[model samples]
Target: MKISAFGHAWVLRWRWMLAVLAIAALPAGLSAWQWQRGEDKAATLARIARWASEGAVGLDGLGARTDAAQIDGMVLDFEARWIAPMVWLVDNRVVDRRPGYDVVIAVEDIGAARVAGSRNAPARAALVNLGWIAA
Candidate 1:
């Protein structure tokens, strides 16, 4: 009887420890899933940020052959066309302390009408939303 009680107690204690370990594992599992999903997006965004800070490749021939998604994500050398935009269009608005504009820098694309938006932007020459700016 004494041996049985000790064995039973050991089982109970192990059960609780296992439950705690499972609980701790849940968050780690979720984090791993999220990281996998965002791997491409994160890498692409990092490259874009680098391009923004360093410089831009020419808007003309850069994205001609490549698809929109690739052009938007890949960072390239600085180009003169990227400097002077056609116009600063206000793409969105928010009600806050003051009005702010989500702007896209419209630039002429070689085969397309325009190129704007983040580095991960589509290749189509359309209005590309870059980011927010104070009005």
Candidate 2:
């Protein structure tokens, strides 16, 4: 086969471009893999609460001294409990009375019906993720 210099140059350039693209893909691929692993290990707040309740560890059992190995990527269950006195509700923005100013907060049961606790309405509080809000 007779190969032209122009064709060879084009092929080399394209190969270099592909190599650059592959290099750029590494960090993104790594980030996605880490995110997926986190998701796999993640547990919902309600699930954690339910687990604690069933484990006979009541909410109190989960204190600061508690092992981090217990709940690593646990997400808060928003639908588990919806209390009254909508402090501030606009559109879909429902802000509960603050326990502290942060992305996460723990609230006490102010006479709201418990969920997934027991047969009867069990009073319970929960750690909630208010999520990030735009200042």
Candidate 3:
């Protein structure tokens, strides 16, 4: 069978286009999967946050140092505990921070929760006391 030059060129171009489309679609497909799994992700994150807060309070009560080093350590511990699991849930990092050092916990549908300042302190304190937030 003889193929025309135009036919051959069209086939090659079509193949290239398909490849490009597939490559572009990859990230979108992954995003859809993440969204479908969002509830589970959110639940896992909330659980981790709760645990970290509780832990922090416990360590603080036990006279864990409140110095900068200690605070940084606690923040790291909290991130490791909670943020790691939901790393894929958001396009960016799991936690976003404000200029004033507030923590933003991202949820799929409801947007973000701010955990800082006087607003979340009571809940944070309770979680800390329960030994969930880490030292």
Candidate 4:
């Protein structure tokens, strides 16, 4: 004729257990979904860096001597994706010519310039070294 205390306790605890299980499962499910989608943040950033660097290097060796303005243009073009928006930065006419050198200084300059820009220093220093812009 008496209601049992054990039965009441089970009912109270079951709800809390279910809530905890749901909270724990949500993060696990999201991570599994991300992995299945092949989304790797680090790898994606590396690829972007490589692509930007290669593009910068290619700008060099387009002519007998690389100019500072040209380097400036390359850096501006590279940063156009995120740094500056809707501005005509790189001068295609200047960079259009290919230099005789096997290695392009602009590419190396671009990589360094990008790093500098991210660090809050003007990318001009790296650009100057590559002869893409004036110091």
Ranking by TM-score: 1, 2, 4, 3
Ranking by lDDT: 1, 2, 4, 3
**Poorly placed runs, candidate 3 (over 4 Å):** 1-12, 43-135
Q: Model 2 over residues 1-135: C-alpha lDDT tens digits?
A: 233685563334667778999999999999999998778556455567666566544354456634555654443233343443423312344346433233555565533344445446656666555664532
Question: Compared with the true structure, what per-residue lDDT tens digits does model 1 show for residues 1-135?
Answer: 122564463334667778999999999999999998799778888878876776655555474555677667544433323436455757457646667887766543433333454555454344455777777
Query: Which 10 consecutive residues of model 2 have the lowest summed lDDT?
Result: 85-94
Tens-digit lDDT track of model 4 for 43-122: 65566676568664432333444555333333333332222222222333233364322212322234545665675544
- TM-score of the candidate numbered 2? 0.29
Better of 3 and 4 by lDDT: 4
For model 3, what is the alpha-carbon lDDT of residue 38?
Answer: 100
Q: What overall lDDT goes with each candidate model?
A: 0.61, 0.54, 0.42, 0.45
Count of clashing residue pairs in every prediction: 11, 1, 18, 14
lDDT of 3 by residue, 1-135 (tens): 333685563334667778999999999999999997997677767766765776643322435555643343343223212322232211222223412222334222111123343433332221221122211
Models 1 onward score TM values of 0.38, 0.29, 0.24, 0.25
What would you estimate as the lDDT of candidate 3?
Answer: 0.42
User: Which portions of model 2 miss their true places by more than 4 Å?
Assistant: 1-12, 44-46, 57-135
Better of 3 and 4 by TM-score: 4
- Worst 10-residue lDDT window for candidate 3 reads 126-135
